[model samples]
Target: MKRKTLREEIFYKGIGLHKGEDIKLRLIPAENGGIVFKRVDLEEGKNEILMDIENSFDLTRGTNLRNEFGASVYTIEHFLSALYIMNITDLIVELDGNELPILDGSAKIFVELLESVGTKNLKEDVEEIVIESPINLTVGDKHIVGLPFDGYKITYTIKFDHSFLKSQMLEVVVDLESYKNEIAKARTFGFDYEIEYLKNNNLALGGTLENAIVVKKDGVLNPDGLRYEDEFVRHKILDLIGDLKVLNRPIRGHIIAIKAGHALDIEFAKLLKK
Candidate 1:
């Protein structure tokens, strides 16, 4: 497959998950720029953070990238997941805030935007990491393994002891169509009890019933119910795909993750890189 870029520029403005501020994002086509983030709010040269594993430094609610000069972009996993599935290898992501907007708390918005603008092929070959052997990494109870495969595959498992949710497991052979259908619409979810603390600490300030699935003890607070019964695990797979994209290539392997989050995802990527 030849390298791909967007057919036209796409734009969006939404609430930033961390800062709770309206942020603007513009996706611009590029020849071979790779997936990069340009912070329009910062000065030139100090405003860019190339989406590379080395630049991935934060492991909180989502994956974040920070440049040498300390310029940062938060919650990029959802957007990166869309780019990987869409096979978008080159583009300039212009952001007018510190975080990508948490649109519906899933990759659906970005996926839709990409589909609308479409893609164009370039002369460059597609970049991918074809694994030869198993790469395993673990952090406490969370772990991930990458094994050889013909295409990108993700097997994600999530476990919560809550009454409404116990265990969710899903394995997906990810492609553009599969991603959009199976994973893109699964919104991020959080416990109702954590809302006050998160808000008090200025974290996840943009979270609400509209963007994320707020879980109560016995059910969800979202009146729309669920998009999918197994959405939780599917969203985990989505996050992993985005985190792996930090390797700066498509991952041609089967990734098995158990209760893994941003921190463990970065650790697994480091092992894959070496």
Candidate 2:
């Protein structure tokens, strides 16, 4: 497959989830360079973080990447996930803050933005990762496994003790259309009990019912209900797709994830990278 980049420059502005600060993002087309995040707020030479498993660091709440100079960006998975399914391989993402905007807490907005501008293929070919055998990584009951497959697929299962969200399972042979329709709209969710903990940790400061699904013991707090019946699990699948972009290549495999999060996803990605 040919490497892809955006057809033209695009810009988005919103509030950073962790810092509750206004942030601006600009997408610039590149011929063949891999996806990179540049912190325009920082000094020129030390502000870029290339998306790679090696640069990934385990952070609470979301995925993060740090450059050799210690410039870092947080909460990148949602944006990366949109780029992955869109087949966008090469581009520059410029950010004016340390974290990305948590727009509606899903990839929906990003997907729409990409759809509006579209992508163009470059002259270079993409080397896709084709799993030939089972690759497994487990952290206790959480596990993610990639099996040999001719096409990209994801089987994600999520479980919680809460009555409103006990368990949800979904499987899909992924494509751009399937992703945009079935997965992109699912919003990230969290329980009301998690609010204080997240704030104490300096995370989710910008999160509101508008951006995330806040669940109470009785039901959802959002004025509008879920987009899908199994939106929670679908959102998990969305996160896995974004996290997998750390591999920096298209993957042709069946990924089975059970009760996994950013930490396990990064570890699984490292295994896939090797």
Candidate 3:
């Protein structure tokens, strides 16, 4: 398949996940341009920030991208994951804030939007990176290893020291159908006890039962309950897909992650650039 871009522009506005600010985002077609973030709020040069790992910073709650001039866009993983699985290689995302809207804390809404607005194939072929050898990065008990594979796949394992989500693991062959049906709806989760701490630190101000799965000490507080029996692991895989976008191309490999997060995921991406 050739590279693809959005067929038409789409607009969205909602609450930012981190700073709780209202944000607006627009998706526009780009013939052959890869993913680029335009800070409509900035009134200066270099508001256009490429989604590259070198520009990533502050891996606190989500993936953040910063330009040399210090302009930034935060919490981009969910949006990036949607674009990755959609097989979109060229597009322009214009946002009028420093962070993206939380939007239920899953990629489902974005996936649906992309499906409805649709995509148009560009003339260029997608740039891709295929793992030809094993690559491993580890820090303490957290690790993400990539091995040679013909196509993209991931086996993620999350070990939570809690009764509700003790240990959950899943393996997914990354594709549009699998991503949408399996990973996209798995909401980002957090412990109920941590809400006050997160808020006091000025983070996750927009987080709520509506946007995330709130896990109590031994159960969940979300009225809807779990989407998948092992939604936690599925969400980890979902995040891996998004973090991998820092490669700026499609990747074909077998990835195994153990208790990983944005920091470790970005570390792996950085190694791949070497």
The lDDT leader among the candidates is 2
Candidate 1 CA-lDDT value: 0.89
Candidate 2, residue 87: how far the Cα is off, in Å: 0.6
Model 2, total clashes: 0
204-255, model 2: which lDDT tens digit per residue? 8899988999988878999988898899989999999999898878999999
Candidate 3 residues 68-131, lDDT tens each? 9889999899888998888888888999989888898899999999999898887877657878
RMSD of 2: 1.0
Off by over 4 Å in 3: none
Q: Could you tell me the TM-score of candidate 3?
A: 0.96
Worst ten in a row by lDDT for model 3: 121-130
- TM-score order of candidates, best first? 2, 1, 3
Report the error of model 3 at residue 108, Å.
0.5
In candidate 1, stretches whose alpha carbon ends up further than 4 angstroms from where it belongs are none
